[model samples]
Target: MSFAKAQDLLRLALMASTRHFGVSLEDIRAEFSVSHRTAQRMTDALELTFANVTKQTGSDRRSYWKVDDPTIAQLQPHQETAVEALEIASRRAKEEGRLRHAQALEDTRNGLMLRLSARDAKRAETDAEAVLEALGQVTRPGPRVPLNQKIADAVTEGLRGPFRLEIIYSGRSDQARTIEPYGLLLGPRSYLIAKQPDRGAELLNFRMDRIQSAKCLDEWFIPENGFSIENYAAQAFGAYHDPDQLKEVVWRFKPEAAERASEFRFHPKQTLQYQADGSLIVRFTAAGWLEMSWFLYEWGDAVEVIDPPELRDFVQGYQRADFPSLP
Candidate 1:
């Protein structure tokens, strides 16, 4: 492709990417059938020439490319409609008590809107309102312990400034705690990932709603020993973790649920294999057998624990019709 053609194709790709989120070099290479070197050149061009080319690093530790300036926003009408559909999905997620996904969709909508000119934002909001009204949709947040903004602010400030924090936790008593705030996870419930008073201890998740009060302390700290929020979050099935309990769990799905089981995403770090006999096997390493059991319970008898007998016993122990008296 000629330089002018490559630039034009890139501009169009960027316009779509700006509304959707961001584009990757792989996207450019596949779309334009260009070399990796050419894709890099396109990214450089977009960064240099665009007014608000910015990067957003999500909790998953992936960087999405975006153009964030209002003056130069270039979302087409169809792109606007697609984003509106996302708004609708956000509303549905909220209604279904999936607040984490609701918050994510809202954030994406806000990011796209932030890139629009003031007039455009107003116009688009009005248009979206009408569209949503026609759809007659509504939503609400999932069940969660009510959050205390003051506590949340203290935790956020500490993490942003890379400082230590002091907490007066009303757990079992009037306990004093100091921590290095790492990351905050907003889900059905919220948690603060931090390094606590003990040195060399693993990062722990503290329920924000449980803390009585929090203060940003002057003592400085940093994420040491190569800690990344993404890596830390990936170490568990859900929110609980203990390094000692980490295990490679394997489960085989009977032929009845094999196809569905194969399609399901068990964990971010997991592997799946289809047996010659038609069963499906899945495995992942994580530190939360108790938590994992909760999710696995829903699969019922369709799954068989192939490795780590402990988890299998835990599951079977709960598969009781009634409490039987022990002899």
Candidate 2:
């Protein structure tokens, strides 16, 4: 096996040891299908770096290697669960023809799963296989690209300095344009927030999926003062957010829906008031009409747009047009 693959197996063994036997080297090596000598070498490598490895007396009266890092031990359960979820999601993405994204997610899931117990690893693989089988039947085909890492790196670069980017962007009308990038933003979806030379004064939001190609430019631009990504995202929904687009919206939910809505706060701007009928009146500011539409649609017939005639009209239009009609 490749050294990286072997190392990954070793790490999973180590993690499992911590959870089940307080880091027994013998147990770990056996789990990885490795010899005692190789397992000793692996433990030695970890000891050199973490300084947490030591010999301990087990119930069998044998001395075994152990890792005493409480923090790492605490994360074992969560790490295993997250790895399994990622594996399931990755397989689903693949069956849907999201080849690039699936590969990337699969790689990440494997890497993370290698830090979990053998039992968890086996469970994840089984679940992933099952999910893929189900996905094969129902997944809708779509144009998918592995854009998460690219967007994350680009955003990091932008946040570090005023990094410039050269991007081939596909617009709303499906027209492609080359543009110089400014800042990147994490909206409901990741967006390349930049100004196009042709579209002066308008900071355009380009969906990462629509970006055909991107290159970091030699030139850079300084970010304007008082502009924070967190603040920007808090005020907007999706990728079409602008500082000037904020507007208050009110909605009423049926009693059953109101009880559900009360359990979670949808937005920082959201305000909920209890009605006499045990329903809820929710008020929040939206960056655009698109966000309001999506919020309403998610609730089905449980919600009603109370104020803003435009929003109510828009919701009504979608209800009448989008749903199938019975003859």
lDDT of 2 by residue, 1-327 (tens): 578865554565457345645556676577777888887776666666566666678899865665665555444433545665776677666554445557889889878777768887787667656655565344333433445556445555654556666666665554545455555563234566666767775667777767766666666775566765566666765456755557777888888678787876767767899999988998877677776697567567777888767778888845432333211
RMSD of 1: 8.2
Give per-model TM-scores: 0.67, 0.52
lDDT string for model 1 (1-327, tens) is 687775565564555355666766666777778898987777777777665677676556655567666434453332467567879989876654456567889999998787777877788888888888888643333465656767866877898888999998767767779988888776666788988867466677888878889999998875777877777777777778778768888999878679878778888888988899899999988778887787776676677887777888878755432323211
Per-candidate total of colliding backbone pairs:
0, 0
Q: What is the C-alpha RMSD of each candidate to the true structure, in Å?
A: 8.2, 12.2
Q: Which candidate achieves the best lDDT against the true structure?
A: 1
Q: Model 1 segments beyond 4 Å from truth?
A: 1-79, 82-123, 130-142, 198-200, 317-327
Regions more than 4 Å wrong, model 2: 1-82, 89-162, 170-190, 196-202, 209-212, 242-245, 260-268, 294-302, 313-327
Assess candidate 2 and give its lDDT: 0.64
